[model samples]
Each structure stands twice: as structure tokens, then as C-alpha cells.
Target: MNPALIERLQAVDRQAESMGRGERSAYLKQQAAELGMSLATLYRKLEAVAVKPGRKRRSDAGKSELSLDEAKLISAVLMEAMRRNGKRLMAVRQAVEMLRANGKIEAARIDEETGEVLPLSESTIIRALREYKLHPDQLLQPDPVSRMKSEHPNHCWQIDPSLCVLYYLPRHGKDTGLRVMKEEEFYKNKPKNVVKIEQDRVWRYTGTDHASGTIAVRYYFGGETSANLCDFFIYMMQAKQDTLKDPFRGVPRMVMLDPGSANTSAAFKNLCKSLDVHVQINRPGNPRAKGQVEKANDIVETAFESGLRFTEVNDIDQLNGLAERWMRYYNGTQIHSRHGMTRYQAWNKIKAEQLILPPPADYCRELAVSAPKEAKVSPDLEIRFGGRVYSVKDIKGVLVGQKLLVAKNPWETDGARVATFDADGHETWVAVPQVVFDEMGFRADAAVIGEEYKAPSHTESQQHAKELDKLAMDAETLEQAAAKRKGKAVPFGGELDPYKHQEDTLAARNTLYIERSGQQMDYNRMEVAEQVLSKVEMAKLLKPRIEAAGGDWKQAVALITKQYPDGVAASQLEAVFNQLKTAGRLKLHKTA
Candidate 1:
């Protein structure tokens, strides 16, 4: 029998052993037909190697007089020879030669009747290897085929970034100036370095729908980055062409991607979360998870990019224009391999019924990548982002240096949206401030209102400015006074300590005396302030100590010394401990 036929029969037999009697019979019949064998021949093929119970071996089954142990030792020696020499042990003749060279045959028992030494046969060795189930071709086995599939259009979209090299005209010194020109002037102006023959490497982002094979490709001059990915994603979702229409318009149910720098960014993850889209990262070392996009890249290299050799591409825009045209031709005209129809046609067949479009304009903007950053609000209620100052108006009571979340406008960088986060990490929109510039150029908190000038006014604006200046001066005075009174104040500053001066009105009230209390019932505010602490203010200072100490006073003392390094006196530490205990904030054991 042919080796392939025998192998097929063995595989079928193993599978059949696990089936029910009826199923086994039906399976065997079907396999017989598929293998172009008669039922009797298949059954005979299966029975030839069937396992037998309690079968006795013939006394002379092996002509060789070697025992089973000696046979195994000979086989081991043969395998070692092949391994050491980096060769295959396929023939019994090779094994026999190795065994004789190692002097194993010299000790073999002679045949009693023939008076000659018995030789090892090829069938005996082959049968022994088969009986032990060792496979010589194990390393040559093919990888299991991937069965990943999408059921409908936009069910899964694969996105990837690739780099391609092409030729473009280099810009001259004059051509590189910052100036807006007409289309004809921009493209027709011949640069002195037109034929410089420099390699123009461009980053290309491609997204492909798994089911319908619809694709969208975009080109950029920069490397793979979060901004580039976001821009291309937006273009792929919104831009429409007359030839291809909007075959790849809907938001994918799940976007599959490899673990690339741009794809794994926080901005990208945030965008997916905002859009309510699931993201799937390919397994490490398994790039075939997004095979559709990879195939599309191969097509671009072979079909679209090869066609660009004859065209004159001068800039990134021109390259993108060519890519846009090529994408339409590829997606709208060429037939897909699996679907046997144009991707556009296949997509349109089910898109209207199955695909889900993106959210409304406002929601889409919210879902777009904003690259959020946490920043401190300045004293003037302003935050700096991207080298521009943005001022929040009507923020009189908001604390200076408070952390606020600032995110850029996805489509532009001129201004950003500011938000305030609570203790629970919930963000609420606070302001959408405008960029500030002034007579001296980009002054802080000065709104840029284009080319308009107005006469000075004595309105609320000036009054607010004056109030801000007064507060600033008072703060500076307090800081200087705190520096002079450091030992009596807190560690960093005396800004919130009790010894810091009380409010002006409160101090005046404490100095006043009523006629009924002419015996001098003066309220010493300083003594009162030392013992009284608002729950909020008290918690703010004690929480860290409580957490560090974990309710152990000695541990807290050590931690304080480690943190402060100036060495707090034991008496002062005990006083604060007792104060905190009386306030029901913490318990310090008396033993300490």
C-alpha cells in the first residue's frame, strides 16, 4: 500500500474510535468515498494494523538472536549517530552499519540451525519506530490555518500603518518660505533642487473591512504617531469619493490592530472608549490576526505604488491625491478574492442593513482624539497649552495652582477645552477658553480679538484686575512674613497655619470690647485658632500622617522625622497627637 494511503487510513481509524457505532460506520463510508477506496478495501486497510489482545510472539520472529534490551541499545546507538552527524536514520542498512561499527553484532548469538549470525531487517526497525509512534517529519508539520472571519460589513475593521519610499521634488530655500500661494503657483514653480533624487519616505495608514474587503488608505509625510493615526481615521470615516462612494463609512464594531506605538497610545484607547467601540490587539508574535490589512498593504505595494513610478509626485498632498484615486479604483472596480465581487458592491449589498454609522457631529468630536493633559491653573485663572495662554473668566473663588484637565481641539490646536475633576475623578466641563495675545505679543490672560482697538474703560474688568492685584500683594506679604516666622509655622509655608494672621475684619472684632463686658472679656483669637480646625482642613493635614503611621504612634514619629528631617520635639508631637485624638481623627496608644 502507498504510504499516504496507509497514513490516511490510520488517521481515519483513530477518529472513528471516538465516534458512536452508527457514526463510526457512516464516517468510514464517507471517508472511503472521499479517498477513492471501496468500503471493503478501507475496512481491510483498517484491520491490517488493528491492535490484538494477548497475542504471543513467535520464538523466531526476529532472525537476530539479540534480546529486546540489546535491540533497544542498538536503536539508541543508531539515533545518536544520526543526531551527531546531523542526518536522518531512514534505512535499516544504515542502523546495521552503525551497530556493527560499535561492535554490538560481534556479541550477537549465532542462529542455532544455520550456524550464521542473524542480520537486522529494515522492516523490523521501521515497525519498531512505528509501534513507538515516533515521527521523523514532526518538525515539517504546517501551521494550523486561521479561521477568523467577520459576519457582516463593518463588523471588524483592521487598521495598520506602513512606510513606503518614493521620489519627490526637494524644496529650495526660497520655496520653503511661509507663504500662501495659488494652486498653479504652488505646483508649477520649478525648484532649483527639483531633480535632487532624494528618498521620500511616507507613512501610509490603511483600514480594511474584514467581511466586504472594503478599504481606505491615507498618506502622510510624518512617521507613525497618534496625531497621524487620528487624522487618517477621521479621513477614512468621513471623506467621500464619487467613484468609490462611502463603502467604508460606518464605525466598526471592533477594530483589530497590532501592538504598534500609535495604536497602543492612551489617546487611541480614549477615542475608542468615547466612541463605544471595542478594540482588539493581536496576540504578540501573531501578525496574522489582522491579515486583511496586511494583504491590503501587499496590494498597495504591488498595484498602486508600482503604478506611481510613471507619475510626477512633488509633495505629500500630491502623493495622497494619487492614493485616493488608486483606492477608488481598487475598491470600486477590482473583484475581491473571497467575495468574488467588487468590495464596493459587496459592501453596498449589506451596509445599509447591517452597518452602524458614527455618532452625531458633537459626539464625534468628543470621540475624536483630544490628547488630554493635567495642568495647574495660574493665579490669573489661566492655563498654558501648546505655547498659548487660555484664560478662564469669572473664576474668582477657584484656588490657584489647582489641577485642571486640558485637552486640545482634535481638528485644531489654537484653543482647548478645560475641565475640573472632583475627588472621585469625575470631570465636568468648566470653560472653553480663547487664546490670548497682546500689544507686547502673547501676554498672559489677554484675549486676542483680531485687529480691533477700544478706548480704556473703568468697568468691572478694571475693578477685577485691581482686586486680583490686591490679593497678589497680600499673598506676597504673607509669604515674606512666613519666611521670617518659619520656626513657628508649618514645614513648607505658614500659609494655612494658625499663627498666620487672621482676616482683617476678624482681628478687629477680636480687639473690640462690649460695654456689658467692660471687665475685659477680650476674645483672644490666636488661642482660639490654635485649637479649632474645620473638618476639611484638619483631614487635609492629618490624613497623610494617619496613613503613614497605620495607627502606630512610634511608626508615625519615625515617619515624621524621616519626612521632615529637622526633628520634631517629642513634646510637640505628643501635643498634636492628643489634639488629633480629641478631634476623633486618630487614636494614639498611651504606651508610646
Candidate 2:
């Protein structure tokens, strides 16, 4: 049945015809040599041909003769070609040579393209030559064509689950909550949830914008189970509008996916409806369609985050912060020669050159929420640098009763400030210079011992150092104070009785709150002792007979600064206009 096998058979026949009379062994040996066949193959071929009644010689075997119709079928095909071209054509010659090579009939012609084979030598070819027909001048060949390419971002995306784990928790009696923390023999001995969700190593849903090369990557850090899949799909669904310039624009045309519940859900389809992205499941065990994204996962999980050592992180907030920073860096700065530019650059540069994806008309759009109000800051202004707000017992000090500036730190932007603190631990009426905070010292940083240390404010540090100079506390007390201050909490109010120790309380509360009740206080008493600036509930204004300058805090503070270390008394009328800015509003350029 194989064409090569037929050629070998024909070759064997040619060699056999050259054999002398009664030279069966010589013929077999010649076949073994010429065809480079073993003795077994030669014997098999000889046996196949020698199928005369039972051990008849191959030459004496009675062959199943061809019928008149079959012989004529072959002859007609050959004869028709000959009549058309006198066997001078290449196809005709090849046909005749093929017939002769197989001993169908002895075909021969003067080394011509088309060979005329008379059927005198073999009835098979002679009968076919009698009527066989074919148009021998025709030729056919195939042409090459170009393949199609994707046109735009999100043309295709790929998703997969890379790892999985399982865990079990033994059930415990409900009395676990009745115990106290200090009473427990060991924290590990406490009973927890009876069932623990199986965690995967790290599953990623990475959406890559094919045209721009931008990516939205998220990790499955929790129960990457069915429930998590639902959440992931929901979030991805919401991303449809956020990611596109037009919510009605095209979605990821194709999603090449691996076998993962997160990727296979109808819920996912419902979400994709907002953008109309489609899904394409990969063949079982075939990951070729997602090779690029898989490679990207490797870079992120292993090479970028860390080197294959899957260390657990503390929290999601931290992870998101890190991811945000990395995304900003990757999109705006990282240059990739393959994509012709950075992701952001590509997104901006690509135009009609990009592949166009027709969006679904019914695709819904999502509007982003309004941005939070931003607080303007003076370049040198001071403010807190964290997000949590705290409640405090009112501590009397410089911040009490007086109007103060409340603005965000330009560099930190974590929290707004009600007032600024002086170098000394006192709350003073001065603008804060938002210095770059690199406070590496810890409250109990043992390694930070022996150095001349500074606490949060210059005043506290100088006072503490003074104590150190006075040698009041031995190394033991030094260690204790060092432990408390070094740990970062400038504590006060709740534990320390503010009424009994107002100065110390003010020193600890970091922030200064003004008192509303009327009171009289010394100008520098905030640093010296308990002092509360009182609020002016109502005031009557009258035009002065003499020429007077306008009201401005800076002009006043600058004039006060002229009295350096002994500024003019807070009670003096020459206190450089002690009045608020007109309209109780601020103009940043003038302030700056």
C-alpha cells in the first residue's frame, strides 16, 4: 500500500529479471545486496511473489490476470496522452516510465519527455494504451498568503491557576473564647476555625493590553476557591469600564484560559457582558496560547517579587501600595524595545496602525467616583504622616485658644495638621518645614544604643540629653526611657493625668488643641508651663484715627521673629496686627 514499498518491489523485479536461469539463490542474494535488505526481507519478498499453488517458483506462479475492463482502463489513459502529444510531454513520459518500471508494460521512447509505450510487451499497459486519456499539458501549484494579526489592546488575554494547597483544622469545644490571652499556656494552643480554606501558591489574573503592552495584574492570596473566583470575576467585570476610553468599546476579544473555576464560570460571562470580552479555553494540558502571560507570571512571582521563595506578606494594603508604585514605574519608565516604547508611551503612540476591535454596542460604561478633596500646603508646612485619626483628652498648651494653620505635608500627604511643633517639644506659632521623614529608630531598637539620640522634637531631645548630662538615671533608667521613646509612640492624655501634669501632657500629645473659654496666658508660657489661648467669640471693630497697616499673620510672625529669643509680648498692640486674614480664607501664592 505504501508507494515506497511498491518502488522497492519494482526494483526487486528489475534485479530478478537480470538473474540467469535456475539462479533463485543468486537472485535473492542480489536483492539482499542491491536493496540493502537483510536475508529475512529478501526471503519474505521471494515468498510473497512465489505464490503458485503451494511452493511453486515465483516465475511459474499463476498471477490473477487483469480483466479486459481493467486493462482497457489503463491503456485508454496512456493512449489518449500519446494521441495528443506523441508521448513528448513530461507527465506522459513519467507515466510511461512508471508503467515500465513496474513491468506493467515495457515502455520505451527516445529519451523524450513523453514516452510512447506500445503494449506489445505487456497486455496490461497495451490495453490501457488502447483507450486511456488525460490532458498532459496542464500544471498546478499553490500560492502563498499572509496571516492576520491582532489590532488593538485587549485583543486577547490569558488566565490560569498555577498552584493549590489544602489544610484541615480539628474541631474544638466552644469554650475557647472563655479564656484570657495571658492565661493561655501558649498562643498556638488556641482553637481556631474548624475548616481552613485551601490556599493556592499564587494564582494570577493578568490582563495584558496587546497593543499597548500594559498589564493589570492581581494575585489570588486568599481562598482561590469558587468563592474567590466569583469575587475576581466581579472585580474584573467592573474593570470593563475603568479600563477603556469608551465603556462601549471592545473587550478582550479572546481569553485564552487554563482549567480553573475562576476562568470557567458563567458568572464571569455575566461580568464580561459589560465589556463583551470572549473566552477561549485552551486544549487540555496545552498552554501555548498563554505562553506570554505565563512567562510574565514567572517574572512577577519569582524574579520580581522575590526569588521563588514565597514569603508571606503582612497585609493587602502594603501589597497594594507596593504594586501601585511598581505599576507607575513600569508603565511610565520601563522601556521595552519589542513594544517600541514603554506601556504608557505605546498607548499614546499607537493610532490607525493598531488593530481595530469593534466594541459591543450594548456594553455598559462605568463612571469613576469623584476624587477626594485635596488640602493645599505651604512648601515648608508641617503635618502628620499617617492615615488614622485619634481621640485625645484636651491638653492645655500653645495650640489652645489661638488660631492655627491646618494643612497637609506636601511630601507625606498622610494626615492634616492642626498646628506645628517647634524644635523643642512645645507647640509654637511657626510654619512647619515638611522635612523628608526617615526616622529609622524604633521604640525598642536595642541597636540604637550609646549614640546621642534625638526624639521627635528638638525640645524633648535637648531635655532628655540634659538629663543624660545630669546623670539622673543610671544605665537602667536610660534603657527604660530609650525603650519607650524609641518605639515611636509619643503617648499622652489617656494614661497621663493632664490636669496634674499639663506641661508634660502637652509635651506628649504631639498636637496642640485650642481652648474656647476666655483666659489670660503668657506669650512663651506654652514652652514654660500650661497655657491655653482663648477664642474671641465676638468683637467690635472701629476705624482708627491714625493711618494703620492691614491684618496679616506672617507680617506679625516675621515682626515677632525680629524679637528673636525674646519676641514682643503676646499682649502688645504692636504684635503686628493680631487679626485673621480677611474673609477667613487663604491665598496660597501670597502665603508662599
Candidate 3:
């Protein structure tokens, strides 16, 4: 019984005691009825001033069919067996098969008399999986989908890229010496197993209208990238079909896509914003938020891509041509399942007046894929923009050493624009780089100084755009350089020399400064002192370098000062350097 309930019963008993004998009997009966117990039971319960406690049941009596550790192991095995993709409840069955095959269940302790192993049934495995609570990605079913409905055709679009299993010949790199591999060999080799895996893969990008269920797709020879997304988006926005009068082509109000690197990239986001389109990211691990396009992707896989496997797809052009033919049929002929009409029919119902087309070429050029960066004009009447030299021929030697803004497109860096801003932050001079393409279509330098022009209002700095550009350039340079040199260079700190020790010390100090955002203030002392390597720390760091140079401390000083090209670290290390010299550990080559 609850303590509160017992207190109420005791209070009623006290009230009964205050009444006469006849009244007490009536009150007891009333209290018994209120307590939902028989009068005799109530009397017995009240008579016992101190109640006897009932014996507690053992928690592990019946529930100990499987130990917690054993259940966890089984659940882990099930998660591994199923991985991230399988039908619902399929993992439970797979878990049983795996456990039985591995003899894990047989290894369990058997009952003494019955000679039966511990429970390892389908239900038990299912219970374990639930109890373990695997991540949504690890489970067959993902998180729930909740997407808003669009009222018009151009209101929203879903864009995503999926790999096509069918193999295709490249425009180049399909050497005559190498024969086309069979489909079996292609599927047998995973991406990690193949050389130049991206080149080996083909991708299909889809843009499905939210309201009308109309889909526009584009094929690419290589795996998906931000460049592929931009080209595909442009294709969908500009494409027209003769089969259907006025095909689905427009700048949608909103475009929903997965949070993949390519979709969420700065360039891609800028492209969408420039076109006045809002971007909505589908929740991570939840693909069903874009169900329409996911269904379209399935259709492309089963209906379209399957047909391409039988034909000779020599290049991306051939594949795109075939895809266009399929799209024509899908848009004009096939009836939409939900609307009970063809996609084209449903799209046309909205009328042409309701749709919005893409902006003109000149306006589109301003919104082209590019990121902003600040560059200072060098003494040569040019700025180092996107790792290449650029200048304005119209105004040579006009803005030397002045700060300028550079808008670089990693996909098309040769045509990057440079602009100089005045005191009011308005662009004074804007020019595009006159890039020279090498024999292999790589940039050498600007052929002629670029011409001046007006900068657009949409110019803004891109997040980590320069880093991305640098990475791309580094990859290309590495690939080219590696072909000639088979051996790698000695990395920093890998050399067995005194210079390495000093280099490591300088690197650590630099990292500390960068991490802490420069000098820190001593609030109690009301003094500001720069965070520099301590004298003891510097001595310890230079000990190896001094020994390596045969006890010559000057070598360590030279190595340390080399790190500070602008003399900042040299000035900071002066105090530590003086202390070392005074201790006679370091020699003063030119003393007073």
C-alpha cells in the first residue's frame, strides 16, 4: 500500500473513534466503502498498528534468460551483419543465422537438467536491437520525412545526383590497347579497388518539380562534383524539348537538396542566391524528405539506365542524347501516378504566365559561379589572383601596391575578375584576366593585361574559396610532378639535423600564437606581453640543434631567425637569445 493511502485510512479510523458505538460502526462502513475494501478487511488493516511487509520478488527470476553482456554482443553482431542497408526485421533473422553459424549461441551455458542453450531467438535479437538503439544510418529505416507541399510548379525543386551502374567510354583515356571491361568486372570492383575511380564512375543529376512531379536530368562522364551540379542546374533551367510545347524550365523559388559537399558548397549556394532561389537542405540521414526526386532516381535506375547497358555509350554526349529521348517520353507521354495526368499536362495546367524563366545572359554572367578574395597589387602593376598573375592593360602602373578585390571561379579561374575599391567601398576599376592556355589547356599566365570594367553589386567573399582553389592546384601540380619524380621529399622534422629542432620549436610557437589569437593581457598587472617561447623552453628546443651543429650555437640562432622572414620572431626571441649568450652556452661572435 502507498504511504499516502495508509495515512488517509488512518485518518478515517481516528474520525470513527471520535463517534459513538453505533455512529462508529456506520463511519467504519462508510470509510471501508470509500477505501474500496471489505469492512472486515478494513477492520483487520486498522487493528494492526505496525503492518507486516510482503516479501519482495527477485528482479532476475524470470528475466535472466539472457545476460546483459550476451545480449549486447548479439545486438552488435546484428548491427554489423545488417550494416546500413537492409529490409526491416531482416537484420533480426540475419543476426540469428550469424550467431548460429559462428557457434556463439552454442557456446552459451546450457541448463543443468534440460541441457538447453541460452535464449537466442528472433524476438530476443529484435529486443536487443531496440535496447541498443542503433543510429538511424545503421538501421534499415531512416528518420521520418516531413516536407512542405508546393502550390506551384516553379515554387520548389529537388536536386540530387546518383551514380549510374552502366559503364561508358570517355571522350579520351579509352586507350586502344585496353578493351572495355565487362559489367561483372565493373560491379565487382568497389571505388577503393579501382584506379582513377572518379573517371570510372558516371553520374546522373535530377531536378524534379515539387508541384507537377516533372523531372529534368543530366548525365556526366565523371563522379558528382560542384561543377557537375552547376552545369546540370543550368541544363535544367535552359533545356527545351520539341515533343512537349514549352517544357519545364525555370529558376525555381526554392530548391531542396541533400547536405552533400557539392550541394552545400559556397559556389553552389552563391549560384542559387544569385538566381533568387532559396536553398532548403533535407535533414541528414533522411532522404525521404525529397521523395519525389528519390522516386525519379529509382525510375532512372530501373527504366532509363537499364536500357543504356545494352547499347554502346561511347561518350557523355551519346548518354545525354539517350537520356533526352527518355525524358521526352517521360514528360510528354507517361501519366503521373499521383495527379492522374502526364507531367507536361500537369505543368501546362499552371499556365505559362505563372512560371518564371532564367535571367538574360548579361545578368547571368554577374551571377556566375565565383567567390570574392582580397588581393594587393604587386609592384609589377599586377595582382597574384588564383595563383596566377593578372593586371589591367588599360591602366598599367596605375594602382601598384594598392589593395584590390579579386573574384575567382575555381571552375573557370582563367576568366577571374579583379576590382579596386575607393574610400567609399565602391569599385573604381574592374577587369578580367587575359589568361593564356598552355598546350594541355592549363593556364600559363595572362597573355595581355585585362581591360577595365564596372564591378557588379553581387560580389561577396566566398567561405574558404581560396583554400579550395589552392587544394585543386596542389592536386594538379602533385600529379604532374609525381610522374617525373618517384620519390617524395623529406617532410619537415624528418631530417636528422639541428635545423629540424629549431624548425619544430618555431612551428610550435607559431601554432600557439595562431591558436590563442596573438598576445594575451595580464588583467591584474594591467600589462600586455606577447606570448613568446620562454628562455628555458627556447634552450630546451635548441639543445638538439646546437649538438647537431657540433656545439655551435650560432647555427641554432640562424635557424631560429630564418623562421621570422619579417623579423617579428627575431625581435621576440632577442631576450631569450641574450640570456643564452650571457650563460656562455651561445658565443657572441662580434662582442664590444
**Winning model by TM-score:** 3
* C-alpha local distance difference test of each model: 0.64, 0.44, 0.65
Model 2 lDDT-worst window of ten: 537-546
* lDDT-based ranking: 3, 1, 2
Q: Write the per-residue lDDT of candidate 3 for residues 1-592, one digit (tens) a residue.
A: 6888778877876787789999999988988898899999998888764344698999854453555665666666655655344533445566657776877753245678999666556665555445555432345555555567888878888998987655544445544221345656555556553544457567789889888898788878567788788777777777375625547787788889999999988777766654656788887877678888999998888778776646665556767888887887888788888889888888776657667777553345445566567777554456676677775544422455667666643234265555444577543334556546589765465343376443322212232444444353443454543443344533222345758789989888886434555677666756766655643566566666456534556555664455433433424565544454454445544323
TM-score of each: 0.39, 0.28, 0.43
Q: Supply every candidate's count of residue pairs whose N, Cα or C atoms clash at under 3 angstroms.
A: 0, 28, 0
| Model 1 CA lDDT for position 9 | 78
Show model 2 residue runs off by greater than 4 Å.
Answer: 1-148, 164-202, 222-250, 307-312, 350-592
lDDT of 1 at 541: 62
Q: Per-residue lDDT of 1-592 in model 1, one digit per residue for the tens?
A: 8888778778888899999999999999999999888999889989986565797999866443445555566556555656533476545566667667887753344567998876646665555444443333332234476688788887888899986544333455534221222344334345533223223335678889888898788876557888777677666656366524655676667788888888888777666544445778887666667878999988887888777666555566777787887877788889988979999888787646565665544445555545567778676667787677777544434456777666654334365666554577654444466655667776654445886654433345566665564353443454554454553544334355555456765877777666574476778565433344433444456566665555655454454444445533433555655554554434554333
Query: Is 2 or 3 the stronger prediction by lDDT?
Result: 3
Candidate scoring better on TM-score of 1 and 3: 3
Of 1 and 2, the candidate ranking higher by TM-score: 1
Candidate 1 TM-score, true structure as reference: 0.39
* Model 3 alpha-carbon drift over 4 Å, by segment: 1-82, 86-144, 172-181, 188-193, 196-201, 239-246, 309-314, 351-354, 361-366, 372-592
